[model samples]
Target: MRIAAATAIAIAIGLAVSLSSVVHANEEKLDYDHQEKWQSALDRAQSPIDIVTAQTVRAEDNEPLGLQLWHTQAPIEKAEDNGHAVQVNTHATEAMIRGRHFTLAQFHFHAESEHTLDAKHYPLEGHFVFKAQDGRLAVIGVMYQVGDGNPAAQAVIDDLEAKDGKLPQPSIDIASLLPNQRDYYHYLGSLTTPPLTENVEWYVLPTPVTMSEKQMTTFLSHYPHNNRKIQPLNGRAVVHHQG
Candidate 1:
């Protein structure tokens, strides 16, 4: 009996050591320097800019404001906690710009928004990532403030709690999550996350949608700060468009 107990203790210690090593390896893989890669070389068009609203250029009157999102038709499939953020996936979400078709592939949120409005940060920001058939990318950014709690948003948090994911990316309707006033600020930028891919189109809404304190708390609990720091505008133009 004594010999058996000693063997059991040794096996348990070995298992714990193996698990600790695996966790450490994963942490090393995730810990990366954005500055060492594409960010340093292609620094001109980085995203998460502080939009000085006063300085934004007005779109020409003759220009066509071609951005359109058919969010009502979008049906979410599943949600996953992708370490960095909770990413909600959908097979299809449609959009159109200047006669070009795009699909909203997935969306995720960042706490304490990536972009700032006249140097002010919001509680949360959601990025709806869209992709054109030819591989071009456009992202629609919506800011969330503390106000009347959004039911659809709340439903997402509830679903995440039920599932117990490492992160909570809500599988809610994109339309239900957006602000009624879609007036937006548009520009050319890069992906906030790495590879830091450039030449992406960005449309950030001026009017913010509301989520309650509880919703904010739950999201922050998952990721206290996932947002990238603000990059320089670098002669880029941000246009104000009427929704």
Candidate 2:
């Protein structure tokens, strides 16, 4: 009995040490302000820029923005706190933009919005990250204002409220979260978060979605301010898609 107890203690200590090493190895905590520390973040074409509507031009090609979002009944694969914000990873749902197919990888929220419209910031912003077949990325930004209760937003909030860390499988209709109108401001930018890789295509919808005060409160309870400061435009032409 004594030998068994000693062996159990040794095993537990070994496990703890292993876990600590794993965490330290993966820890890369670059705060929103510290983006300059990374070379990629210093690029002139960085993202989360303010959309100046007056300066924006219509696309030369005038091709329709052709947004095809799949409404899947499949349950959300996972929902994670991510320490910054609540992120929901979906399955069996995808979106296409201008003939390029992109799989819906995940969607996350930011408080006070990363991108602003005419220099006005919304209460919340949702970024739907999509990965194309050729390893390119396209992010859809949806701004939200405080108003009536939104069932779709509530569904995601409920999952976060129930579990702070990683949530089990949750049923959420991601399509319902988007605005009815798909008019957007298109531009070439970088990722809002770090590594801040350039060449990412951003499509920011002008219409704001509705979320209740209670829902906003719940989200703020976790992340009061996770938005990064807007970056410079650097001669990038923002194309306006009416559709």
Candidate 3:
């Protein structure tokens, strides 16, 4: 009996040590330098979007934006990341503005956060990509900060339970998670991903929603360093509303 108990203890200790090592190794692999990589990647992507004055944007004609609908199982053609941990590229659906009969082609998440205004880091950031019939692209960026509880964000995290690296069915209704105000910061930028394509119309919400510290930590656990540093303004204009 004594010998059996000693053997069990030894095995348990060995298992713990092995598991610890594995966790450390994974963390190391996730340590990516955001600035260097993003700069190089952005340089490669220089496609510019047709400039349209913000004043010319027709609010009445724009389609009423809806919650993002996602499906992780629907064949992810691409999957990669920057300073962030995981970005499972998968098919998704999103409603375009009224005049724009468009839909979201893909969606992904960023850790720690990205798309900073001036100089601020949000807890997390989710990017939904919409492609127009004419090949124009508009990216809706939802900014998240640590706060109370965010049901919308929780929905996404819950669905991620069984999926870490692999894409899983996404719990959506993301529109509700967004700020009530449609006001945003519009700019011309490149996709913040690999082989960065410059053909991107960035629609960044000026207002941000809240998430719990626990929730933020949950994402950080999977991706400790998610931001891709910051990109230069490059003589670009960042337009925001005065309201």
Candidate 4:
């Protein structure tokens, strides 16, 4: 009886270890610590930090964050693998964020998401990178949840399916990609990628847009893991705004 009890305990321990390995294997495919060697990545305000809702504070003046994203005639120039995330370039998409005008430079997707709400990671995340004449950048983040098929998402995904990279037909509406509700979390954070530049404004829309399983699979196939790991908050003040 004693020998049988010991053998059972050993089997259970081995099973747990095997399950743990499987979960980790399926989570990410990138070298997560690739930024550890970069000095910029070690700075005070790195991006893709988990937004702790309970800890975030409202601004002193409590002014609302006004965003003006407009439809444009500029065609989507191209969509490419970019050896990082699936990126789409736009020519004339314009944005008037908080009374300042900026042009939509390009947008990209991150598999498994870079930013997380509380501690939950979404299936996908989209970064709409806008640039001002002064070279200042303001990125609007949209999280993608698994549900109905998103037409805007499909536009890019369809191109990816046809070719490994570079869109054969460049046509997409930047406005259609965003969710109905415009509420977002405003914070001062750096770029998630290399060179990890600081002082960029990140407006992360908390509400997630829907994407079908097949669509998710198609995007993931091109780049399985492109998201950077969540960096520490480091005493930075994060604020949330209503639409």
- What is the C-alpha lDDT profile of model 1 across 60-141, one tens digit per residue? 5655555676754455645546677766666466877544687877777888899999999998998887766656666789
Q: After superposition, which runs of candidate 4 have C-alpha atoms over 4 Å from their true positions?
A: 1-33, 59-65, 72-74, 163-169
What's the distance in Å from true for residue 124, model 2?
A: 0.8
Across residues 153-211, which tens digit of lDDT does each residue of candidate 2 receive? Answer: 88787676665555543677777778989888888776776556666678899999988
Which segments of candidate 1 are over 4 A away from where they belong?
Answer: 1-41, 71-73, 164-171
The global C-alpha lDDT for each of the candidates, from Candidate 1 onward, is 0.68, 0.72, 0.52, 0.71
Model 2: weakest 10-residue lDDT segment is: 16-25
> Residue by residue across 130-178, what tens digits does model 3's lDDT show?
6656555667777778887877556556655654554453434546556
Model 3, residue 33: displacement in angstroms?
A: 1.8
Select the stronger candidate by TM-score from 3 and 4: 4
* Residue pairs of candidate 1 with colliding backbone atoms: none
lDDT of 4 by residue, 201-238 (tens): 78899889988999888888887777888888887767
